[model samples]
Target chain A: MYRDPSDVNRVASLGAGPIGGGWTAHFLARGYDVNAYIHDPAERDALMAVVETGWVSLTGLGLALGASMDRLTVTSDLAEAVEGVGFIQESGPERLEIKQALYKRLGEIVPADVVIGSSTSGLTMTEIAAECETPGRCVIGHPFNPPYLLPLVEIIGGKQTDKAAVDWAAAFYEVAGKAPLVMKKEVPGFVATRLQEALWREALHMVANGEATPEDIDIALKNGPAPRMAVQGQCMAFHVACGEGGMATNLDQFGPALKWPWTRLEAPELTKELRDQMVDGCNAMAGDRHFRDMAAERDRKIVAVLKAVRDG
Target chain B: MYRDPSDVNRVASLGAGPIGGGWTAHFLARGYDVNAYIHDPAERDALMAVVETGWVSLTGLGLALGASMDRLTVTSDLAEAVEGVGFIQESGPERLEIKQALYKRLGEIVPADVVIGSSTSGLTMTEIAAECETPGRCVIGHPFNPPYLLPLVEIIGGKQTDKAAVDWAAAFYEVAGKAPLVMKKEVPGFVATRLQEALWREALHMVANGEATPEDIDIALKNGPAPRMAVQGQCMAFHVACGEGGMATNLDQFGPALKWPWTRLEAPELTKELRDQMVDGCNAMAGDRHFRDMAAERDRKIVAVLKAVRDG
Candidate 1:
């Protein structure tokens, strides 16, 4: 049903927004001929612009042997775009009905054995696969921002998804130089997003209370836990912090602090003022750079970190 | 009272345990003459072992000019460690009584202008400065593990702490290649540690409930948020996730989900079973490597990340 990444040369991107365009750029950079499908004809220009911008970023990260911008093909015909692609990555709008309808249409076109992965961030594959003709082949292939650079791809399967398909997608992503973590359980927002949400909620609470600024929070992570995080996982690092006591010592020492208000997991209300603050704060952090330029800069930094993590 | 990093030749480590030894190694790597105070005469060999181990990792990260183990001087006599040093870094112990007693003794010995920094992770500077005659000079200069590699040093001031002293310490740390985040208002765990505690608490709960393994939780971070975390803060990354919508869209979309059971900020009871699983999970992750070896590897990787972040 599936082949190695070498054999699976053509991949289909079933939406050409930022996430979808990112998938296209990543696939192209991985030397896969990317056939992108879009509902609107005007999107061809904007989507390809994203691909060209991403291409430069991927180049800084280093591309595959046969990678090129010429590998991207935009098509108005949905069936034609996915025709014989070994893999289908869908990044449609977040609406359930929209995704279900797209999956139903894609199922009718793509080969039944070819794996179809949804880049849906929070939606579960179980719900998304409900309308697919061959539910067993559908799974979540969630990638972090600027997919060509950040290596993590969460491989999650729905109740109907075949474990084999999940394994195949996981293996394929690895060959494409992505770190894929398979979730045994289907948790909303997945693990990373869940962890991220906790910290994010806490940050918002701080901003609302004026305890800290957004720039301060960003600087805290970029210069602090992240440098350590690039090397070892947070829990593993906590294990090291336990000294002779291991996690047991850390748990004993810091466990009580959890009951304290260290983190406000419950989000602050997004009042008009708070909303304005958050937006203004982020804009200030971005400063003069355009989003694409900031993204390219992010991709460059991520590449360096990835290289260090791999080589070290 | 403080001089440029080049002019400030000597710094003192009031304790020669893991944290103190780390400070010693880091100070030495920054080309400071490090005088380390230990409780027992027999502790010198073990303390030096830790410093020597840290030096190799720091050297790999690129050592400062004149950096060497030859610059480290260990003594059991407290006065010998702090008498001539420009700054004092106290990582003695967590017990408030022990730290207060030590600070009182140091206040009587060291010069009033020589700033004394406590590496106490959770304890506030005010509590630690209670017994010090010159409490204004005492500040919290908390460093993450393997301080030579990780850039963050949380600089906090006590109630009696002079604003100028805090500013001076912040400036001094920046000169030593450390990113200092000054706490405008002190909380229980401070910023990074507070954020870390929330994630850690949630991770423990997941493991306790059999929802995820320790490795699963760790892989989730290393693969998912860590790469992103290496570059941007979690909050900044969330800002990017909002697309053109920015932070307001992110909040509108996901803020309500915060009430969901994504993170259990209240930690699970540290039952024997949970503790054993945690220790065993971390041990399995470490495999045959000794703690020191694991620490060394972590140091090397952190150095790589720091280099990437700095250069990229």
Candidate 2:
């Protein structure tokens, strides 16, 4: 039987690059004694530098009780790093073969019930855990850059992984001060990354076509939509913009614009089925709040964000 | 001779919908007496409601000296609204025919030197001004929704528009407390809208495919990239993520992911020329600030925003 995520204490952080170092800092800030494994001992100084830099923002955000840098332990021996840890977070290189070999080794060293979460942003857990004897306990816990600051950690389970392990990882991330988005099904780049890449590609197209420069795009985004998006996501923002009518009103008003050659990506046709799904989805997100109330909340948050940005 | 944009005190706001009403409120908050034109008399209450609600947030953001909502005047007669006004902001229907007819009448009413800025997000200035007698004075001053709070105003000129008019409009927006992105060339949806549409389409695709729910996307975005994007934009955010190496290191590190089918939208080829342009653009945006300093500033702003969000 696996130990409940709440009962887990010490954790192993494999690899100490940017993502790995960020995870190490995050785990340490959460009051966990971290055994950080690096491939080469020469990276020790650089890894320490990341932890120190990350600690500043973590302190500002408030550190967990009993959190200290002294609790961190670094080593080059893989077996020593994984010894007696309750959980394992692997942030190895983005290579299928390397990850398979690493997982295979990790599977043999750790108990069958110990969860191993890979931090590979590109490769999926399905491929990474292919050679592991205990693939059922392996999952993906992808974090955005500067993981200690950003609250999102995308949780995905591979084809062979057990659902219980995915649940355990999600609960663990939540306990560790993260908003874990447990995906229903695996997709390329997951949620946030896909959305980001789509917008990024469009920006690149504009620059390549000479429609706008990089600086122009940045100014347009930061000044126009970025602040609002920070407060409310795209769908909710549009729903609130239509006032009391909500998503149905928004779709009717601007759905035709989606068909317009506004973006290079061809939009999925707005069939009635898709339309209903979106309307219902937004309604569910809104819960019992009226459009006016949601709009007020959005406005309040936006004001706070603008003030913060201005003061900073 | 046209009065300079700085000297313009009273302006005409044609149409009384959300965009026009928001613009009316923004202009009033900026201490301008606005002559608001509406086609129907029944829309008076709705327009007033928008202005009233917008005022609350505008007040929170701080009002300009001598600002007053009582300075606004509503009129049904088009000719009466444009009379003696120093500038005109037409947010009439998005249809090209309605706008062309409206612009033709306005061109006949106002002085040839008086600048006219349209808030049309879809139709281009070139198409709208084709029927006008003085197309040279007409320019696009497209704004995002809830224009009273958001600071962006994209300034683009039609083929027939004079360069001086675009300059005057950009200068005027600055005086009105708006960040105007003067586009080098007009493209479909311009910059911000295109970027937004690309992301929205991908989001729709995800929902239609049952890969994720609206709530999941919202949580993923708001918790992950939205806060950072609020501080530094997409390009600069990635630039800072790579630390001291800036864009060059970032492109070399994650540029391959652009081709990874991460998004439905196809990415532009990352050619040598494109890479150079992106690097130079980011370097220009960074100015003399070192990467460490920029990263520190970004963290400070993000922390402030997170605190505001949490407190709100």
| Per-model TM-score on C-alpha atoms | 0.81, 0.95
Instruction: List the candidate 1 regions with Cα displacement exceeding 4 Å.
Output: A1-6, A241-312, B1-7, B240-312
Candidate 1: count of backbone clashes, pairs at least 3 residues apart or interchain: 0
Show model 2 residue runs off by greater than 4 Å.
B77-80
Model 1: lDDT equals 0.72
How large is the interface RMSD of each prediction? Answer: 11.9, 0.9
What TM-score does prediction 2 earn?
Answer: 0.95
Chain B only, TM-score of each candidate: 0.81, 0.97
What do the candidate models score in CA lDDT, each in turn? 0.72, 0.89
Give the lDDT of residue A308 in candidate 2: 88
Candidate 2 lDDT by residue in tens digits, B163-233: 99999999988998888999988888888989988999999999888888888888888898889988898
Residue B102 alpha-carbon offset, candidate 1, angstroms = 1.0
| iRMSD of prediction 2 | 0.9
